[model samples]
Target: MKLGEGVEAAIHCAATLASVAGNSTMPGAALAESFGLSPSYLLKHLNQLTAARILESVPGPAGGYRLARAAERITLLDIVLAIEGREPAFRCGEIRRNGPVKLDASAYIKPCGVNAAMLWAESAYRAVLAETRLSDIVAEYAAEGDPRAFAASCAFVERHQRPQKSNPTKQTPARS
Candidate 1:
């Protein structure tokens, strides 16, 4: 089965977010530009990630988005679930019951072999994804990356990113 739209983008975006300095946020536009994707298209995926709590949004001129938690704690399965949902990809309609070869109704009582196989495959796939986390990806990148260049790239992202900093003097009064 094909991956849902924006799944790749979400992973890449999350990786970039993980590499950048702590508490730093990057605007959707800049992230989209970096990936050579349409801002609107990327925004849709970013919204999905935010809804899944993978990324947290910060508002204001300097505000943007950052990871809600450590990248190591967020698995590929989590991202897949956030985008594709928890529903099974393959749904069996029990078409065997409707075919020309009408079998006894009692035969329908058991699980279909094809359906069972698909479910098993899905579980295996999910298990693999669950074991892979964003940190593992970043670690791989770090392993292959040139130290100076990697630092520079991260620096560039940090330079372009607008950090969301709260103004101490601008705190709102608490309501009774």
Candidate 2:
């Protein structure tokens, strides 16, 4: 089954966040630029993650984005659900009754072999995804070399983003 663009984006975005320097934060714009995406569009995805509690959005001058929990605690399935909505990839239409070879009177006696196989495969896919966490992706990412790209992405965010003054009344130190 083909996953949505949002799902792919979320996975990469989470991986990027996982790689952020300890003193740095990854804001939406930086993420967008890294992937040559639109800031507004990236924010939309980021909001989904925030709503899922996968990422926390910090609002203020020095604020940006940070992981809500450790990477090991976050799974690829979490990213998929955050960006793509928690829905099964395969939606069977129960085609057993539609074709010329319609089901026999005893069809209800047992589930067709095809249905059982599909269900089993889907469950296996889910189990695999559940076992693979963002930390796992991060390990793979580091192995590929050049983690500095993530730091650069954060720097790009800092350079291009305007400080968000959420309170207006309260002042926040500008991010360096």
**Judged by TM-score, which candidate is best?**
1
* Global CA lDDT computed for model 1: 0.83
> Over the stretch 1-176, how does candidate 2's per-residue lDDT look in tens digits?
77778887787777776655443456787788788888997888889999999887887666777677778889888888787776666666767768778766677676667778877887888789999988887776556757796466546544644443356674433211
What is the Å distance of residue 88 in model 1 from its true position? 1.5
Model 2: lowest-lDDT 10 consecutive positions: 167-176
Over all chains combined, what TM-score does candidate 1 have?
0.86
Report how far residue 77 has shifted in candidate 2, in Å.
Answer: 1.4
> What TM-score would every model get versus the actual structure?
0.86, 0.75
lDDT values, one for every candidate:
0.83, 0.72
Q: In model 1, what lDDT does residue 162 have?
A: 72
Ten-residue region with minimum lDDT total, candidate 1: 167-176
